[model samples]
Target: MNQPASAIEILDTTLRDGEQTHGVSFSPAEKTNIGKALLERVRVDRIEVASARVSRGEIEAVSGIIDWARGAGLADRVEVLGFVDHGKSVDWILKSGGRVINLLAKGSEKHCRHQLGKTLGEHLNDLRANIELAREKGLAVNLYLEDWSNGYRDSRGFVYRLMDGLADTGVGHFMLPDTLGVMTPEQVTAAMTDMIRRFPHLKFDFHPHNDYGLATANVIAAVQAGAAAVHCTINCLGERAGNASLAEVAVNLRDQLGLNPRIDETHLVQVGELVEHFSGKRTAHNAPIVGEDVFTQTAGIHADGDHKASLYHTRLSPERFARSRRYALGKLAGKASLLKNLERLDISLSEENQHKVLQRVIELGDSKKAITSDDLPFIIAEVLEGKDYTHVELLSCTVTSSLDLQSTASIRVRLQDEVLTAAGSGNGGFDAFTGALAKILKKKGLALPRLVDFEVRIPKGGRSDALTECIITWACETGEVRTRGVHYNQVFAAINATLRVLNLQIQGSLQQSRSIDPTA
Candidate 1:
């Protein structure tokens, strides 16, 4: 595709339309934080903060954002949604310190007659009155033609009449919303092209919904058809399915359509995380750009292909989004995938050992078991030795805890003929166990990596004693390592994984330093 000379403007509505997702709400501080992130970090051109007169809390939320935007010299770039309520919404907007208002007006004849119970002339007069009132209040107005796509299709005369009436209103922009998300990309392209040609001087913004999973596609189509700006929500959050996903749209424009998008691509995942934290709406693992599995290569053939050449990948590079590519070992994992895993652990395996280990990995995967890099050492020992390997072993462990009592742990570890014991107390039994291990490593002048992440997953609808899988990611000076443990007890699995991570860090660091400096 031929690249465009300039990037399109991105107006993020995560704080407004995104909040409309069922059971999602952001507190004032969260709203302010997200506003800052979207503007400064994500580098979006503008943001729609909230709707006017929604609630006292919403009023305060917009106020907080306005105050912050003013200090950051971004007040002019911030916007709020308002209704044509004869100065009611304008008054709330002014009091909240918002300078721009996205005025919502009836677009289609059906909405005018059925929803507002007004004739075409009456609806135009009411909108004109509201626009005049807002102008008098010193507020910039951008008009939202709610259901505009439907208006263009089913009621072209009514839509053209409304636009002709507003031609002299000095509105900043005309926002066309596919409110029902019913338009295909072809429809969007044709409608947008016609509107831009009909109203050559009017700036157009395209807002798309995701009910049919084509919001991103429709957004690209509109941009191609001459939209000056595109509206998106972080994490694709909105009513019903969602709005166009900001991350997905931005990436698509840059890579697929060859349109320059002025976005800080590295901050894409961070924006998704902030939105997820505030909105409490989780992003699915397979969601386009910011999803957990989007960058993870799951099939072994794909992993091998990636290793040889990145032919299996799309233009969406994980590194551009502040994420690393990951290869998931499963029933489909091949030799290339196992080699990559071994390389991360600084372990070398013969071709014979590699084939044997690959067979076992596939068997475990076929049985629905997940394997991590940390499990490879034990697997190697078991498969290679054909018997239990006694290189390092846990001799004994004792844990004690009670309500309102300090938790304590004592552990004995054996390395061949040498045995070491350590004891400690902590806020919880698992913490106590980790504390004891930390003390033992300290005695050996070893520094363990800090545990940066911990997650526990228990199958749904399982019994109380159902197996729990604990995954932990530890960050050391060298790099990050992940380990997994499974047991019926969640606490036990976490503790076990923590211990293994610490041990691996200590041994790996010691070996590296020794190789570098023989005197040590």
Candidate 2:
């Protein structure tokens, strides 16, 4: 039988170290919201909310959090970062009703010599005095050995000397930070094991940064080396690269390491979305666990493997994190992927029709176009219409726009060769086009859905002919749906997306009415 992995505690520091990211600052209200969400929703074991005496705003933010945590009866679980400054930091912590402080201390001799201009003995004495003062002031202290990794590498003897001096200072924990994020997993294991051997009685916490994109890996190493807690931030928000990401760390610890953390995996993506919105930093589409495309398989072979036996997947299933796997259609899509896409759209194609549609889809994909499920009917209508079936078609559209000039669009559409044209004008060309479309639909006694949202994405590598992808969402009496369009011009993309939505709506209404009364 295999031995089970050890459990490690999680200490999230998004509000403190994470806020240190350049050009990122959370308002007091924002900090309070994030604190509540992290504690009550995400359920990390502890949260380092802020630093002491940073600013009046920070003080208020920590104070508010302390009040909230107190009401929730979790006051002790909240912590604040402080420094050894003759009890000034202690005073700030006490004033803010913060009971726990991660006291900042020099871990390396160079920091002591250059930053404080103090000898090893002098620094130890100062720390002792500060610890005694903190104890007298009723503050629980956790020592942060700033730059401890560098200390272990450069001056191991001095590092041990400082730890030995403060070993019995009634400190609650020793937080070893990779302050410069320079340690590899091997180094972390070696240094952490040495520290554990030297101070067997002291509880150790590990804080890692992401300057090298190895913070999560280092966190795992720390746990393996017997760290009691590891610090993380939501979305890896911190100075420079970032700190270890909470979602990645939590899931990895649970699934890969077989460690149990009291985190609700289902809420991981929701929390990431909330933070991304509040921080005004959009999460990249490819971000692991919480990105739009992480669960979407775009390659046909991968989709086929997934359909067969989930052969292309890892242990991280999308459903485990409240997400569903998606099959994307493009040049890379195979027959299995196309069948899956058709299944999602509730459309059945004959063997011959499937090949024709697949060919067209591949041709479009070769041009770097993205086809959505809503585009299936239009493709079928164009390919199979008049030959094997009668279907709806857009006959012609006239659009005009000029600055301070009358913008107009006249559209003529044909349903089984019955033609209808409508004209309208508005402030912009697309707007006028939509107005004319609505007019035509109303005159033909067709009910049009309302457009709820519109978004345009301009591809990178700017050029006049660069492809623009437009997505539109529509809401109707029956339901809501989304459609995507691509074109060289932004306006053209929008127009295409709008037309797709309209086309889908017409097809859906026709099918529903036919289903209600087949003879009619």
Candidate 3:
């Protein structure tokens, strides 16, 4: 039989430590937004937002967060990192309207000797004085033993002296950070166990960085060894390799350690994306829980297995993270993959037609191109219209554009066994092509749809002849339609996309004409 799950408090430091990441400084507005999302939406236990006395902008960001947190009655959950400068950091935090100070103390002897040039007694005295000032000023305190891993490893006596000196300071939590991210899981577990056993009356929060890529694993070991809380950041934003990812830590704590962390897992991706945008860092597509492609399965066997009683499913389903599972369409896709995509679009096809469409999809996938769901309708039309719809066809086209000159196009097209050619000049190549096509269509008493948007993407390692995909969105009388086309030249890609749209309209017109009653 399984045991009842343990509970762990989540302290998020995306703003404090995360801001330490190279070239990342969240604006006051961005920090406030992320802080709100972290507390109100994702509902972590606490959030450490910024360091004390960084700048006026830092003060404003922390003050704004305080305003928001106060209105939501969660002011105590907001925290800030502070220095042990004999109440200098405490005064700065108070000016920012912050209620909690995570006071940073030297956890290693080297930090004390080399950096502060203070003996153990002198450092402990300064730390106590700072804590006393914060307490007298009516601010809650949480002391951070920065580099606690090294302290415990090299000089446990110094660590013990610091803890013992502050034992009765009425601190809310004692945060132990593997500050340099240099602790193994076993070392973390052992250290946490020893600390919890020695200071059984105090609360402990384990903070881990990802320099070793073991922060998540080590955090779990700490929690399992009886730490009351664990600290993390959104999207693993921090100095160097970053901190343990909040999403990964939360989910793993729940599933691996059977520890019920206080986090709204569904909003994990929302926070991840919001942080990425503000920090100007792109999250990897394969990043667990919050990545774009984590939920996409691209194997034929996997899709088929899923269809056959969901054999490939797991507890980490996309729905658990407020996302849906996707069966990728490519050369590795099976008929089941096609069916899954078609089902999403609510379109059904006969078995014979399905086979033909799948073959075409495979051929297109072999070209090292991405096929989006929006491309499905165009593919369906082309495969079914094979050698049948002579409504419109581009027989030939020539376009030229030069600097400081009018761009020109000449095109020959066939409409229902009648061939016509036209020439036109415009501002650019695609515009010229459109102008020629418009004139030719006007002669046939046909009107084109309104082009609302045009997007283009070229794969990396580009050359003049590299394949480019053009996606065009049109607003027609009935509804909006999207089409895509790939070509070695960009203007030609747009032209091919335009041709697909024309063919679709012609087919629609033909269908409507046939639907009318002959007697009427």
Which candidate has the highest lDDT of all? 3
Best by TM-score: 1
What would the per-residue lDDT of candidate 3 be over residues 401-503, giving only the tens digit for each residue? 9999999999999877899999989999999999999999999899789999897978777877788989899997767788888898899999988887887
User: What is the TM-score of candidate 2?
Assistant: 0.86
Query: Candidate 3: which stretches are off by over 4 Å?
Result: 1-6, 387-520
Candidate 1, residues 206-244: lDDT per residue as tens digits? 999999999999999999998999999999999999899
Could you tell me how far off, in angstroms, the CA of residue 281 lies in candidate 3 after the best superposition? 1.4
Per-residue lDDT over 437-483 for candidate 2, one digit per residue giving the tens place of the 0 to 100 score: 77777767775578887888877877776788888888966667887
Give the clashing pairs for model 1.
none
TM-score of each: 0.87, 0.86, 0.81
Better of 2 and 3 by TM-score: 2
**Candidate 3 residue pairs in backbone clash:** none
Q: Which of candidates 2 and 3 reaches a greater lDDT?
A: 3
Worst 10 residues of 2 by lDDT: 386-395
Q: What are the per-model C-alpha RMSD values against the true structure? A: 3.5, 4.1, 5.1
> What are the clashing pairs of model 2?
none
